[model samples]
Target: MCASFIVAAHIEQNLSIRKTAAIFSVSKSSVQKLVKQQKIEGNLEPKPRGKPRYSHLNNSTASLREIVAAHPDATLLELCELFGQNTGNWVGRTAMCNALQKLGLNRQKNSEK
Candidate 1:
């Protein structure tokens, strides 16, 4: 945010965009972008960056642990299917694996199943 203001001040003082970029060690596009943001948003202050990530399996951790405890030999697909049936959320294998990892559990089979 401070950098944005400093760049803008230099440009307002008649510094060329290229020179401003060189002094700031930023790209000309970056300088232009900041100036444009200042005009459009009416401030050099930062904006929130990205969308918050939400997991469908967030509400099913306890049931997941119990299911894994019961079926230690389940594959990724089987676990996802079972979890969907239990929670009615119907997520994919990757989501199931990520949820298991978040819960600090193994998503792998104990033995051949």
Candidate 2:
């Protein structure tokens, strides 16, 4: 934690911000910014990564399930088309495939068409 370095250089050793930068191999602005963050946020650790974005197909899961259940033999592209027609929100083949997989729906053909 560079907080320790800032403490040692500025508080204990009484070094200037520029001297701390030179001694610690960090920029003076970095030290100032970190100190400012510590004062404002009351912590030195960086924020955690944000949650994943909601899927594009998130809104129409019910209609999607109805479409897939109604046409169990439809291909992914066909499912995309039907879902688009039914819900007015077009989804790509891969997105439709992924949604189907997430919903535990499979269209694995049994025999040659």
Candidate 3:
């Protein structure tokens, strides 16, 4: 917020974008973006940077834990397939592994003798 205000003020004072960025120790692109935003919106505040991440596994954590408990020998791909079949929401193997890790249910591979 302070950086945006400073950039706006510098732009208002007839400072070039490069000079404003140098004075503020920010990137030239940041100064350019903030200046453009101020011109369009009459304010220097930036909107949220990126899209919010949506997780399909959030509501299925309990069910996933129960499934893992019931089938401890299931591989990650098998678990993911089962979850997709049960919930009708397909998730990748990486997401399934991460979800299991978050639930403190890390799978350990057995050593081949």
Which candidate comes out best when scored by TM-score?
2
Model 1, span 1-113: residue lDDT tens? 36665565666788888888777777889888887877788777777899987777888788999889888888989888888788888888888888888889975544656
Q: Residue 77 deviation, candidate 2, in Å?
A: 0.8
Which candidate, 2 or 3, has the higher TM-score? Answer: 2
- List residue ranges in candidate 1 displaced over 4 A: 1-45, 109-113
Model 3 agreement with the true structure over 45-110: per-residue lDDT tens digits: 557889987778987888898889888999999998889888899999889888888888979977
Question: Against the hidden reference, what TM-scores do the models get?
Answer: 0.54, 0.63, 0.59
Model 2: per-residue Cα lDDT over 1-113, one tens digit each: 46766845675787787888777788889877776777788787876799876666877778888988899888999999998887777879888888888888877988866
Error of 3 at 69 (Å): 1.5
Question: What's the true lDDT of residue 81 in model 1?
Answer: 86
**Poorest 10 consecutive residues by lDDT, candidate 2:** 1-10
lDDT of each: 0.80, 0.79, 0.82
lDDT accuracy of residue 110 in candidate 2: 85
Cα displacement (angstroms), candidate 2, residue 1, comes to: 4.6
